[model samples]
Target: MTDKMLKFVKIGQQTPPKRDVGDRKDDFNEIYDDFIKQKAEEQSSRCSQCGVPFCQVHCPLSNNIPDWLKLTAEGRLKEAYELSQSTNNMPEVCGRICPQDRLCEGNCVIEQSGHGTVTIGSMEKYITDNAWEKGWVKPIEVKFEKDQSVGVIGAGPAGLAAAEQLRKNGYKITVYDRYDRAGGLLIYGIPNFKLEKYVVERRTKLLKDGGIEFVHNFEVGKDATLDQLRKKT
Candidate 1:
């Protein structure tokens, strides 16, 4: 443990090297390359392992930064990915689009100390991407089936998170969205560079495969009202 903590002190910070802005601007491919094994270890070793991790504090989802960072440094990537995903409903998605400069990376203790911040966002992306590549991501496991059914109004992030949690508890779910595609902002609103369409499609497919029904091109106000939906449910 002492050696682990000391590694942070010795290893200076580094981030995933980004492609030239001009080269990246023309296409929708991911902006930064995935961190190779050595690069990931180097980057993870930069975390200060602070007594108070401000990175976690400032994160919208409050991810367990230090634990995952330590795990990453130790090359226990699968455990790191699991810990990262515990707080975040979609670690892979969040790792891609979240504005780290304004959130977690911005508040990193090492960054505040004038050492460069640990590349938390890139490491997160690496962890989840690796997990997916290794087929470690599995479908949600429902313990028992329930009688009550739920109708989710949107296919956006919040709606999807709620649907996943409720479905895990065995609540029947039907998602209604105005757009033809299920993901509200994820499919249409976000630019391809930040998120590939297939990534969003995969999640939508997962929810569908999990047995959540989706009603597309179905506007609530036009097709039905609050009272109507309530009565239907």
Candidate 2:
């Protein structure tokens, strides 16, 4: 495990290549290219595999950073993806949006020791994105349906995550949002340059395929009161 690791001294740090400025100006899209499999494994090998993984310590989700990094370095990408998604609902989204410079990569022990930090975010993104491409990402499979139903307000990140977890436990979930389309901030608020709409759309589609219902353009105060909604659920 440590063989592939601790190569930060030799490998150096690298991120996925950026799109041309002219092309970026043409339309809104992700600026950075995805890291190729070889590059991802190489970058993952740069991890020090420190005794105390500050990367996971600083991460809000407390992901198993070192383990997944080792798995990635060892070319066990499916296992890497499984570990990455265990704690985080959307590793791909977090990889794109999370402020890694101030979190995981920021506190990297090697970076502090003068070697460049491992590209944790890019690795996370690559693992999940590759999983999606390989059909590894699938809908929630509930064993037994629950009698109680749950209504989640807002089709944003938090709401969607809650619905997914609840659905995994076999609860009937109905997400209510004010916007006509799902992904309130993701669909309407965030620019395509930062996070593409299709990424959010596909995630929404997965949730729908898992049987989580969405009632968009419905206001709690206008469409129905809290009491009425609670009673219906």
lDDT of every predicted structure (CA atoms): 0.85, 0.93
Residue 199 lDDT (model 2): 87
lDDT of 2: 0.93
Candidate 2, superposed: residue stretches over 4 Å from native:
none
Once model 1 is optimally superposed onto the true structure by TM-score, how far is the C-alpha of residue 178 displaced, in angstroms?
0.8
Clash counts for all predictions: 0, 0
**TM-scores across all candidates?**
0.94, 0.98
Question: Could you tell me how far off, in angstroms, the CA of residue 65 lies in candidate 2 after the best superposition?
Answer: 1.2
Cα lDDT tens digits, model 2, 15-121, are: 99999999999989899999999999999999999898999999999999999999999999999999999998889989998999999999999988888889998
The clash tally of candidate 1 reads 0
Top model by TM-score, which number? 2
Clashing pairs in 2: none
